[model samples]
Target: MSGDAAGGLESHDYDVVVIGAGGSGLRAAIAAHEAGARVAVVCKSLLGKAHTVMAEGGIAAAMGNRWKEDNWEVHFRDTMRGGKMLNHWRMAQLHAQEAPDRVLELETWGALFDRTEDGLISQRDFGGHKYARLAHVGDRTGLEMIRTLQQRTVALGIDVFMECTVTDLLKDTGAAEDRVAGAFAYWRESGRFVVFRAPSIVLATGGIGKSFKVTSNSWEYTGDGHALALRAGASLLNMEFVQFHPTGMVWPPSVKGLLVTESVRGDGGILKNADGKRFMFDYIPEFFKAETADSVEEADRWYDDKINNRRPPELLPRDEVARAINSEIKAGRGSPHGGIFLDIASRRSPEFIKRRLPSMYHQFKELADVDITAEPMEIGPTCHYVMGGVEVDPDTEQSGVTGLYAVGECSGGMHGSNRLGGNSLSDLLVFGRRAGEAAAAYAEGTARSRPTVAEADVAVAQERALAPFSGGEKASENPYTIQSELQQTMNDLVGIIRTAAELEESLVEIEAYQERARHLIVEGHRQYNPGWHLALDLANMLLVSECIAKAALARQESRGGHTRDDFPGPDPTWGAKNLVLSLDATGTGVNLKEQPLPVMPDELKEYFA
Candidate 1:
């Protein structure tokens, strides 16, 4: 890999540099600045609109004020169970324990969560959660969280590099070329290039949501962090289990994969058949049958819990719920559009619905021309969070590569297979801070490391940016067309479920995409060239998808977020193998290896169990 940053129209340096100013990135920058490092937050969008703003549910944490039964141990167990036991025990433990402190810290920094009458932060029930432990604002919880972090970071005087995209990592070396020096990025507004020379770098660059055709992810969620890390020579773990959310609005092609917030369901909404009957009862898994309420009578009883009964059945885990909806539609009991109906009208009064779910009402009426309060909303699974990422020590958030760090959705082993609804927000706070602290500490004494950018690396990045404009490769297909084709292939094949036959085909298709990318053409100059940026992103997403599909094929036994019909049960022998994959300096190909699991101590075991 070339170590130099290309298109160096402008150049700068810093003590620490952070890519992507989303929730985790903002928080990391704050911590690094606090640690006395000169920090800069380079982002793709305007400060507030990074993917974090679209997070609709609440932040998961165990404050333990309302429910005495609630604590980090219970939260950890629920996370492991929700992830189907594939989550790293240590990561889950630390995240659960530290989440409450982080949420309270947000409050101290001016986040205003909804409050109970007694005035503690309010919590809500969400899929895969064992308690009403998600601390939230009305529905725009992620927006509130990121806004608060953005404010705090700005107040700290950390440098903000808005509308800039990092194209490569610049490594400095003392003949050996093994350590980090800084990075290269380009300005989006003026078409100017900049090289940020720093001993420390933090990547919190969100997900590969755009990799799927129909997704809740914005254009910014192109797995930038995932791609950046791979190029810098770090191994990504468990890329197989990408989470497909159960309730993306399925009508109006423009909004096809946009998310329908879970808050609707949390506020007494129900999933129904075309005949309007609730169907979750028939689909509860064995592990959760004890906590699941089976009948309408039990469901009605839980509304007040006056004559006391189990919690409602409507709150089942997301995977089981999505599968149930899929079955209902397959049995010809679906709405006209082939999706189950999500209705809140029957359960709550119009006044209650209007007040509690204003955003849902607004979004459906504005975007879909359907008033959610009066009409049944059309819903189906769509691509959402990625479960696999660069493997790190669950607590430290450090990658295998020296001086490299990952946080938020980009780091692996946190959610295991499927992440619970509210857990992501809390996990971001927990690990983002950990990664920032660790990176800052590493940068303190080791500021000038061995690896610095070599001229060859700069040329690789410059040519990489110029490839589409060169217009010499696949002249027949447009870059956007290839991108759309790639997303469809992944969605149809490596989506919610998987098989070895389909995975092998996906591999072939991905290879073809790599070849086609070489010939992609662009119509405009470097200034705001969406096509060029996408062509660049395709390389990353394709690599990420390869890791996911290949690893899915390797793990013959089903566990957590991975469900293979051919290999339907978790094999004890495969107990704790972490599949780690990385690319060489040339980005020619990849090598995957297995690393042993960190042993769980008694303290971790008690909490993990």
Candidate 2:
């Protein structure tokens, strides 16, 4: 809280400025530093608590020891199928191949994963994986991952700015092309602004989970990276594909939708109706016929992998499982509550269940007043992750904004419409490192491509800094209301199994909320106002939702996360297409374009089988 609260009138320069010090952020900083660049990792939260710490599922990779026949091809096929064939092939290919090495690298950097009999890292079964592909550190896999990267990064002595929010991207006004110079940010502690100008800026700010009332995300995930990139004029892809975790705590609506881990399912939890009937067998598709187990005996046998039995199909893609559960509830076969029951109690020994799923048990007992070991938890889909984000090249992870790069959930089109469960952790690790390496490579010979602190840029940053104070003392319409409304609209209208009418209605509703948000107010000083933080987040949610809804409206086919009722079948014409979005004056938003998919080489095409 030192002296100047004059907003962003003051300016600083660096070799690289990274927003969001999560797992991806830490990895990016390390890569940049190793590549000989002065680096800074800025964050809105205390070092280790970024949303990556909250991720409970394991990371996906083909360690291949458990199943010798396994390779990147099977992993790729599973990803495309899990995403309902909406996944980008090149990204999925790179993600699958690089994941094993990244996980091993983390182990070298001090991540202690659960071990097998031979003392190597162990793998486990998760939904949508053909083989046991996910390597984990108990249920707190993401936590172990972030902490490992954090410690390794500290050893390198990289610069870090905590509790600073990036308000705008500092674009190079010099006669340079589409490249960016760096960025400007708001320091929350002192309520001042700091301009960090660098040749490269990497955005790993997670997702817009904070915009929704019910989310698995924490307070720090405000979509800042997406908003900053959008305003800076980089096109986004697949905005319509927002994923809702199939299981979130239901009763005691006050606490809202906290996530129930997928690991519970991996540990033999059975999804049943109130009458004690298992319904997933009815939903298995013919496409998955070869691998999917049909009967309960066959399903159980899949666990042991008897000399000749088929694997369980109940572990089908997340989108498929979520839909199956939704159908159960709709057919009046649900529990006393609206959700289908997930019972791990009867399937496995109580001791094994407790040891493997300690956090799930603890989280439910502490937060929801229920023990999963004894009772089946109530759950329904809530907006969880977005598959689409700032469009970036496969190798570089750089968006159209030359100096700006994206990684993690903020950058989209990676998962297409539906992401497989463990791939997200791997996506962060693999692509995050690539982005860092590429950005650092670009930053090596590049000097300050723009003015360090030109007068005009400082003026705009200063105005941004004083925005909360500028509104009259009694600013109305709480920002949280806008946030809640956003979640409600998206959940009710744009959720799983949507319609043209619903999408159009949601678009109009989002617009109305956007107008209402204009009249929204921020109270008190900006020092630590959660309210002001929420207000800024509302703008991002509004704009991002508009693109999602518009893309949903335009796509006319049911594929991946974007399901339209009028068009119930997947249209072949739309199979290889992508929807691109950006912000401009008219509010009509950016138009759709048919971006080409990577031609799968003959060698790679064999993986599709």
Candidate 3:
């Protein structure tokens, strides 16, 4: 661990510091600690409250508890096909091969998954999988996963710094130049600065969904890790591809963007228009045509006998489903709330609906005053996940920057253009362990002594952190206003569908928000100040928003989550390339370059053939 003694700020040292404390962070911390390294987890909120808790669907793994035919090869094919063949071959392959072990590992750690009649862990059907592959605990799979991991971490005696937000990654300036030395952070409760000095830092900070107006993400999903990585000299890949989950609650002003889990569809719910027409059948894309049912009878029958019939069109990958929903609303067949109707009430029995989707039932009954077991849900597309983040090694999860590793939602390449439903939890477990093991190994192998902290760098960070209060009595710009405007801009222009003109316009609007963010003002003292925290988060959102817009503009062809109205279709040349984003030398402008996709190994190539 690097030693720090600058600016009189509070400091702690550790062999590894894992940021975000979500499923990935906790899992990574466990692996690192087990690998014989002292580890600490830093989080913006209390432990177990990270966005992973909101994940309702189960973890995807070819466990074969429900379907004996399922295996890693089938899982790999589903992943690559669902991603539109744009996923990093190695990451997808590794995720498929290792996911079953990770899920079984969780079971050993005390996760109480729902079981089949024979008493094996229950597996459920989700979009894009060829078999019933998701191991779940009712609809609260994430809750169970987090609870189990949290218990293991406590049992292992790993340290945790709760409600701490890391603002910057500090690097060694002298002989160990460009390598991460530590991180500068602040306590959310007391608003006092704290520095975590560590030899290795793993980012599991999640996505950038909050950058849009309607989203299924929480405030913490402001792209802090993505921005931090760029500032620390790491590149971001495929920034243009942002997933809009097809089933966000579209009614009730307060719950406009709350997620309606895809498990609703997986469990026999169907998408219908206001005229009572099943709409997904008419909207199947050419890519998914071979697997999706063309008729309503076949679609319904597949739920009971998946092997004898094609899968329902409603079970298409998220990108295609979201686009279908968008097109339905645009074609004047929308629900009362400008969305489509998701009818589980008409398809499944009330007892089965309540038993299978208890959370969805309660979430709707309590929040929206609608019982999902009896009524159809008003649903639409809402920004949910980013299929892009810090570009990292497929094997190690390490970024280009030395001593910096990323996993889970903050790291890219696992899901190429769009993620399949139920895949995220497995992703956290698989790559999170790899990141931890690799980071520990890197730290153990380094011979460099503790690096010194420059007083100037500390001073600059302190100054910037407190800048929101600098205007004092004459403070003008409201941080919330800028944040809201930025969200509106992204939602309006760079949303599920995009055009070259709107993307260009979005860049201009983002530039204006960036200017306002610079002058953001916050009232009151630092202690427990939400306004001040949002002010700091604004910087990250702007940087991430810029990357999204610029990358969207650069990629003209429509593919997956990034749809282009002007281009209209995926181009073969564009399909072979990835858009990589980084900070220029000045750190004021974004640099975007196209790179060719990695070739799949011959051993893995047989599965596709």
Candidate 4:
């Protein structure tokens, strides 16, 4: 924890530095420490309060605790199909094969998941899974997972720098090649600049949901990892694929984008429009027709007699359900609030509802004044996650840049265009460990070729971070105002449904925001100043938003999370190629190109046949 102060910047050295404290980052830190590497974790929040705690669903795994027939092969097939077969096959296969072990490992570390009648870990049903495969603890699974990981982290004596935000990643441009050197950051409490010098850096900084007005993500998710990777010479994959979760609170104004966990629907909840018709049945796509129930009787029977009938249409992949909700609202059948009704009270008993979804029961009662035991909840599609992120090697979780790695939501290609409901937690555990181990190995192997953090680079980062305070209060543009406008632009144009005209318009608006952001003015000083922090975050948000808009405009077809109204059907040609975005040589604008998807092995392809 020792550091030298030079040019007003505090510098600390470590073998591996993880730039997030969520599930993936903490797990990576633990693994790096276990591998005998000096590790440090930097996070924007307290130790146990990263945005991972907001995940209410359980970890997806094929432990077969609830259903004997469930296995890794089945989980693999489900994940591939859920992502519309556009997923990086190797990543999906590894995630499915490794998820069960990861979940059990969490239990060994004292995760306390709910149990079945026979005392094995309980598994619940979620959208796009073939069986009840989500290992959970009521609805607080994320909170429990964080608690377990954080406790293990402290016990292992892992160093955690809480309330720290990294603004840029420094690169070592040697005579032979360029490599990652360190990270430039600042403390949120005191607002003092700090630099972490590490040969290996893992970015687990999560998603880009905050760029949208209505999102389930916290303010910390302003696309920091995505932007950092791009600027540090890594490419982002499938940037057009932004996931809008089917259920987010749409009422009471204050909590409009708060998430309503999918665990409710998993435990017998149904979605209905104002006409009291279960609208999901009408919206089931041709892709899932073979497995989804067509009638209410069969749908209900499938819950009790899984072997005899198809699963309910309400349990379709998230992309399909979200689109259906959007269509329902566009029509005149929406609820009083601009959403559809999710009814669990009528299907399950009060005690059962509370036992299975305790968070939903309390969230509604406290935030919206609606009790799940009494009435249906009003929910709609809200910006939830970005399936797109820094492209990384599926085996090692290392990005294209040497000495840099990414995992969880910050790294792309695991979930393709749409992620299954419970897969995020398991993905974090599986790839988090892989990235940590790989980062440590990279650090150990690169001692001689280790990159150095130059004093000149540190000076430039400091100047760029302090640009917002240059012209004082009369700088014309306010950071908050610019951020609000950017959110509105993304939400209105590049949302669940898109068209060429709107997508083009959004790029124009984003360009305007990027220009305005350069002249942003913050009122307060550096110490504990939220406006100043947001001023810095706006740069990342603007860059990532442009990538999303550019990719959305380039891909002219409908598939999974990315849908275009002008080109309403999924094109086979477009489906086979992924749009890769990278910062051009000038480092100002992003360049877009296509890369063919990795061909799946013949044996694995037989699953679809």
The candidate that achieves the highest TM-score relative to the unseen native structure = 4
**Candidate 1: where are CA atoms >4 Å away?**
1-8, 175-177, 306-309, 447-451, 473-476, 584-586, 607-609
TM-score of 4: 0.98
The reply for model 4, stretches above 4 Å from the true place, is: 1-7, 307-309, 472-474
Per-model CA lDDT versus the true structure? 0.80, 0.79, 0.90, 0.92
lDDT of 2 by residue, 1-609 (tens): 122345434567787888988888898889889988888999988888888876777999998857767788788888878877767778988998889999999999999998888887888778878778789878889899989999988899998888888878877776457777778777777667678888889999998776566777888777778878888879888887877787777766765577887888876777777788877888887767777788888887766653343655557777777778878888898766577777787777767877788888888788878877777777766667889899999888999988789999999867988898889899999888988888888887575344343559756866754554455544467777777888888777887878889988998999898777766666567676777666666777788777778888888888766777799878877877888887766634655665765566777777665
Per-residue CA lDDT of model 3 for 200-220, tens digit only, reads: 999999999999999999989
What lDDT is obtained when candidate 2 is compared to the true structure? Answer: 0.79
Per-model TM-score, in order, reads: 0.95, 0.95, 0.97, 0.98
In Å, residue 36's CA in model 2 sits off its true spot by 1.1
TM-score of 2: 0.95
State the lDDT of candidate 1 residue by residue for 386-405, as single tens digits.
Answer: 88887776666777666778
Instruction: Mark the 10 consecutive residues where model 2 has the least summed lDDT.
Output: 1-10
Scored by lDDT, model 4 comes in at 0.92
Give the alpha carbon lDDT tens digit for every residue of 1-609 in model 4.
Answer: 012222366889999999999999999999999999999999988889888898888999999998899999999999999988899999999999999999999999999999999999999999999999999999999999999999999999989999999999998866266679999999988778999999999999999999999999998999999999999999999989999999999999899989999999999999999999999999988898998999998898887878553789889999999999999999989999899999999999999998889999999999999999989999999999999999999999999999899999989999988999999999999999999999999999978877888889888998788888774454779889999999999999999999999999999999999888877777666777898899999999999999999999999999889999999999999889899999999999999999999899999999999
